[model samples]
Target: MTLSRRPAHRDVPETAPVAGPIRVDPRTKNLTKRLTAGDIAVINHEDLDQVSAQALVACRPSAVVNAAASISGAYPNLGPQILLEAGIPLLDRAGEALMTQVTEGVDGSVVGNEVVVDGVVLAEGTRLDMPTVLEAMEAARGNVSQQISSFARNTMEYVKNEQDLLLDGIDLPELRTPMEGRYALVVVRGYHYKEDLQTLRPFIREAKPVLIGVDGGADALVELGYRPDLIVGDMDSVSDATLVSGAEVVVHAYRDGRAPGLDRVESLGVEDPIVLAATGTSEDVAMLLADGLGCELIVAVGTHATLIEFLDKGRQGMASTFLTRLRVGGKLVDAKGVSLLYRSRISGAALVWLLIAGLLAVVAALAATPGGRTLYQVLAVRWDDFWAFVGGIFG
Candidate 1:
């Protein structure tokens, strides 16, 4: 009954699928006791996006608690979860302090089968009641305010000297602002964004925000039925259609003005339009573009702002993201958790079918052997007829 298992380790160089920002949970006990505000708590994995990371990092907890399972337990997540690489200590066991906070938050936030944000329970189990949910959301907003506030303040100060490293050899594209009072959705490559776009479609359809995709995110947006307004990045992971979607194209380049992406876009017949030469990651570029264009709100998708996520992308530090946050401070909104907001369950019928298929296979295999030879012979009076039936199925 045991299924064949693949070895946990493989020698071959396999192409791993790109996933969204790594999510890690804090596992330290007595968080209130062990951690202080402005402590620089590098969360192991919170499934947070760039803005959230910035907000959390801004809190500046006393020390980072890398509760991310990978660093703590080698449990795989989307990317290498952040805390360990951020010069933060990795906590293996969920200590009393951390769990106490999570429990208190959950209890104080919930009533009966419902989760209460403020005094209202948003949902009972899986069904959402928006009124209650909204109340909870409002309450939850300020729960992490101190952290976010500190992160913003600290990052702004930290990046002042590192601006050149962030802006090094990068191009700043000339952005054309066609609409006012509109928001911009900046897409970056990250976890389940493609699948989550199904849920995001309604938001896009309703908000009608200007869509901007960075590199592979350009293709991701297209896959999710969104025609990007402006595709920005090095053109490394985008498609030709995304580049030529008639939206303003901005190529993020090094400070040297020598963009590797420029040549590819040109070869694709995309003429010289606009390219922003900067020294940061494309997500950073996208945020700056949104800011420069005066977008009222910038909702980010799959963007990485954590030191771990930046490091996992092979960058040594988070200097660029740190600076970008200061530039787009209040207007930024991270849509990273939009994916984990829903719960899906297997249907009863599906379970029934699975059980039936498994039983049928076992019965067939058993009947084929000496275990049920007499029964098999009794069922197979005519071998030719059985063979014909099998052949007919193939036909």
Candidate 2:
């Protein structure tokens, strides 16, 4: 054995970087399900909406690195601004390489404007500070007209083919939950859904509408200490715990008989789930189900009601939503953004007037009774004494 082998060099152990673990997800909503505090969120989202932004803020991530543009100059997307406002560092336009290369649970650090993974610089991006987000928003605002035109054209095109399906109504399976002639509260995890749900606390207490959760809305209901009576959606965002919480499940599938969520429902041990193969968004399906099932009134929360909100979602499927609203018609009352508008059904002034009217009525009734004159003298004497006592203290 001739030559002596050289001693092998000892490899130094890599030190752990002072940063949070990175969680990579193309779908922000899905990532949020597992995201925890002080984690780094790497999302592949373009034109991030307000709802998504709020969800991220709730998780309180250390930083956010986006493979795609968070704003994208696509109609003043609010997500980037929200993240910045929440003090979460946002690195935008880091490209696809970062997403493909960085595995979940890797240590991620933000030094200046670069995203370093395990001490290696994975990507560099524009740090979205408040000013940057505002400027981007302003530019995005200018493109609103173009976006609107595109939305309209897309809606018209889709309606030509999907109109029949929407009008025909869903052939819903018989469910244990009753809906005829009762108010239905259909929730979607859309814009400010939590706030809207909280504002409707009194109404929910009084009406006791059938709690219908669309996808993640099921989780939303559970968060607010209410169990959904019916869970409807593609089953992507709905949690397993909520699925098995004794609520009737309605699996929303594609109109062409392709039901991806069905497999998930079955896998979760949810038996007897009604598979409704219908078109449009899950929220639309929920509303249509309520309307078709003879729900007297359907109150929608966290749905795309405003024009700006519709555009913000940046989905072509909004055409279905537009038609679904028309289909639901007068019975549909959108409670999205309701927290901004609703302070009280009865105003303070009105309540004061009502109190005065009642007091006057009571006084008049009491004065008209027998022994009323004697009682009135006694009250007048007491009232004078009370005022005299008060005056004595001051004077």
Residue-wise C-alpha lDDT for candidate 2, range 352-378, written one tens digit per residue: 999999999988988898787689999
- Model 2 misplaced stretches (Cα beyond 4 Å): 1-18, 336-395
Per-model TM-score versus the true fold: 0.46, 0.82
lDDT of 1 at 8: 25
lDDT of predicted model 2: 0.84
**lDDT tens digits, residues 55-121, model 1?**
3333434233333222221111222223323432222222223322322222222122222233432
Give the number of colliding residue pairs in candidate 1: 45
Could you tell me which residue pairs clash in candidate 2? Answer: none
